[model samples]
Target: GIYLPVGLEKAAYNDGRTPIWNAEGCTTADIVYDDLRTTNGWDSSYKIDFSDPCAQKYIDSQARMFADWGYDFLKLDGVGPGSFKSGDNYDNVADVAAWQKAIATAGRPIHLELSWSLDYGHVEDWKKYSNGWRIDTDVECYCNTLVGWENSVDDRWDDAPAWTDHAGPGGWNDLDSLNVGNGEMDGLTNAERQSYATLWAIAKSPLYTGDDLTRLDSYGLSLLTNREVIAINQSSAPPAEPVTASDPQQVWAAKNPDGTYTVALFNLADAPASVTADWSTLGFQGKASVRDVWNREKLGTYRDRITQALPAHGSRLFTVTSHGTDLEWTGYEAEAGTLSGNASTAGCSACSDGRKVGNLYGGGKLTLDNVVVHKAGTYQVKVSYISGDARSALVSANDGGATSHKFASTGDWGTVNVVHVPVKLKAGANTITIDSGSDGYAPDIDRIDVQK
Candidate 1:
């Protein structure tokens, strides 16, 4: 977990004891698996056959030697089931286990990091044996620069979420490398450089820069050295959950233990974008104080929500703390309700619990079977939704007469807005059905909130 260089080494450099080239007069031939042939393809190099006992011995010995040599980290690259596909059913699980066992028996503590998109199916194994596992291919663009967004840096946005729960305390998820300490050589615009660091921090991925430390520009230095932003990464907080699941615009948030929340808004689109973060999705009610973490500026307090216009691929991180009389609100995620016809649950970054019920059109409907109320009365219900175009849907309580509600355009589908509707609820349990009728299409339903 410490970043100071204690020395780092890979497992493929061994010669006589590990995988040997198909050479004559090699004494360690018994350790090599004769059944299959695996090569590095660049030269006459062959992969280490981890299934052999002697090969494992060599790996274990190398680990112990590294530990004794004051090495603090070991990164095993080209691991299988996700990394190298030699087409011979090559799996490096045994090799990883050997290294893990070796490091444990070693006299010194060493960090074990697996690399190049290790299989998530064996994530439990990675979590158990290594300190971190890379979730995507190399972030490097492999061109003249260290990295480029379109090639691989942007790939993490689609891949990291699935591996969120797999990262934590003793072990972490490695997002390749943090390559933003340098300016143009980092191969990203100033906006993108910060956003890159933001995602790696909030996701709690190991933050080791790929850029040269001696050449950090002021903007790149600021992005890397901001204490408030670094605190979010080191807070050991769970990975931020996306409030809006769409691309081009995303809102991610995480709750801290000190009655505060960390929220990040991203604009991945080509043009400017207004990204909004709702208090309901952040699991709080009432006004809250917001501070821009990167700018180290205390923004004024706001009630219910806040919006920021960000440039292309830009991002903002904020810490929000509630300061008003806290109102208790009950939220019923639309995905938890029953779906009929084409209605179904889908991932939405701008919704409560990262999900929403959509496709409510032409016989599609969502029925909440257990909507409870203490007393019979009319109450305000806040329905959260996303709509680029104006739409309407019918809401019926207890299969009673339906009332149609119109939703105005919120500018785009990436933004979420709440509309309050007065609905009468009987004492105890009540059923509410949101239907789009035979031919009408309704806006996507994130969730509905009611004051308790």
Candidate 2:
């Protein structure tokens, strides 16, 4: 989506970009006035009275024009129905609805995203008409450098959790641009950069790179491409929440559907300190193995708790899984299977073996060659997969008839879910296959667990 202002309001009064106000058919009836005129820090500006038919028609035309130009996403900034304390007095619900109607009329799947500290009171309306909405002020410092800590980035930590329930598959809480892909010019320290990326990823905010790609530094590039960290961002899981609301030293955690947890420890103080992740707070029991997501290193197994000495403003991400003494199920990792067509393996820090099979659709398939079972009978096999939208897959055993299973949204691509499928198996080694049928794409498979 291209970033474009709503044009209903301007940075400065009478800055000379008032198409809706100057249209031939439009009159004073289309403009909104009163205390809201200069209350928004602008000396003078005009607000579009969306209630007026002329104003609605004018916005409709603009939306249709943008859609016709092949824009699949639209970031409509400076929208209203916000807080009056922030100088937004008029409602823009009709305006947003007008754009929604216009896009549907144009027959395009353009994503309408509202921006600039949108009102939480009208959240349902925002969700109804848009794919995402900005929950806070801009993260940009608007200085010689891109951004600074005190300006707005830190504000998201407080503002984000308030809107967690509001974010999901189709709609999300946008935290503005992620400006950590460039060094020096990013106006952040190395530790700050990692913290910035970690928070945005775990919060499920859109990871829009707000930096110069051509001048990316090695550290910045690594932060942007870390597959393990990106998995947390892409997961269909909800935003991670503060474990104990402690300042200077904070811990956040999110439980994954496949009985795993993504944990982050932060030292937000000016000096180095110890940050700890408590298993009780994370809702886990027994000894568990931890993997450092950023460094991609297994940190060994621990019981009850794990602590790390972090540099000030530094953060750490880890995926924790319990190792219980049970023989109820046997695991088969997808990445170990034969990938055919477009099917391939990708690093998933949260999955077993740190990899999973993906792109299984349109001739893509995964074949597990030696899926041995003790007896020739029906076994409940748990398919662990990730998906952000509705999908289906075909699973078969020993070249038998395939069983089609429909999967519902798991929230995003990072979160994992398990579905049980009854597969008739032989007493010895048997083969299992997974692929998309004659329908839509298949979910990325993490692994399958056969009931023992």
Candidate 3:
């Protein structure tokens, strides 16, 4: 479990105090007294040095207290990365080792978790003594549009081999906690939240509840519980990699053990809307049963594919069980122009008039004209270009009869940029025009994938 500072514990003890920890104040009652030099005369620079009698006593005492409280896991924080001047070069490695020894000496079977980006190469040494440690910094409460927790995806946690055997039943890779259900979540619609949860489940990190559990709302509770959905996350098999995103609003499918699959349809748009996925591409031969995990409703069996309508910032989690023979190519495929390839770019500029935009890098852009719209619903157009580039691209889809939507590339190609447009279609004939913004550079044109 992740441990908050003693200051937070003190505030909780004192009927809660505002501004959390009073960083500037100095009192014996203040939780930071010893470390900040407000009450004790110990130098703040030597805060983490175990050789310091007061610091050692405080660390040892805290470990003992937590052990008594039945907390087998503890995350030691506030130990800054710099070296100690007064004590033996107080770095995280020494600090953690000291605490581990202290905890062992106290005769408690407590596990340790360290915070901040310490030298993970030393993880092998710490693992024998500690339980888990952070690969990044601490996560604050959800407030800003980009909550700190969302940044976890930017770094691949699975690439770290040291953490492999270290995680299981009682042990886990601490990827922080859920930022959803926190009323402060901004910039995310319900669909986006579902996507976030789905990603975490696939990552198989510890399911630490970061939201105020006592005040959980219905939607939040649904996300936390849905047994079938949660079961896939807890499964022992390696998770399926995400299908390529052709559009931000497209459905991403991951194969499950019993031949069924878990699908997450994300709404990259700010408003509530509905999107559709083609049945043929999903490998359904005829009709298949679909269950909506969130609503606990059966969407009935359908031949070929399933079409789901999602709310703004919300998504529909589905367990699609195939029936009868497998429809010729019934599983998801990356759409042509979207970030994930499972979308269709049939109506984009290049796909029109039988032209195709191919081979653009994941973060590149593409332009097509004379595209045809095969079906109609809500469609997400994504332009993936390289990461860290300051350049942006403008993409517009025109149906020739005056219906058009303009979407901008979200600077980073790996980041899915989305534009939602409502299209009305006849059974056989419709046209679309796509233009890459003339930003003095040719936008790398990946495939344009179209999802309903």
Write down the RMSD of all candidates, one decimal each. Answer: 8.8, 17.1, 12.0
Please write out the lDDT profile of model 3 over residues 377-448, one tens digit for every residue: 433333332222222233444443432232333233333322233333433433333332322232334334
Which scores greater on lDDT, model 1 or model 2? Answer: 2
True-structure Cα RMSD, model 2: 17.1
Instruction: Judging by TM-score, tell me the better candidate of 1 and 2.
Output: 1
lDDT on C-alpha atoms for all candidate structures: 0.75, 0.75, 0.46
Clashes of each: 6, 7, 61
Task: List the candidate 1 regions with Cα displacement exceeding 4 Å.
Answer: 1-27, 39-52, 84-88, 324-452
The pairs that clash in candidate 2 are 13-44, 234-414, 235-414, 235-415, 236-411, 236-412, 236-415
* Candidate 2: segments with Cα more than 4 A from true spot: 7-45, 83-88, 324-452
TM-scores vs. true structure, each candidate: 0.71, 0.64, 0.48
lDDT of 1 by residue, 1-452 (tens): 32211111223434435443332333245444453245321212344565556565665566666876899887777666567443444466666777788788878888888776777667788888888888788899899899987888876766665566668898888898899988689888988898899999999988888788889898988888888888899996787756544445777788888978899999878788998777766656679999999999999899988889999888999999987565567789899999999999888887778898888899899988788878887655778887666678888789579888765444456567665555788988888888998999988898887767
| Cα error of candidate 3 at position 447, Å | 12
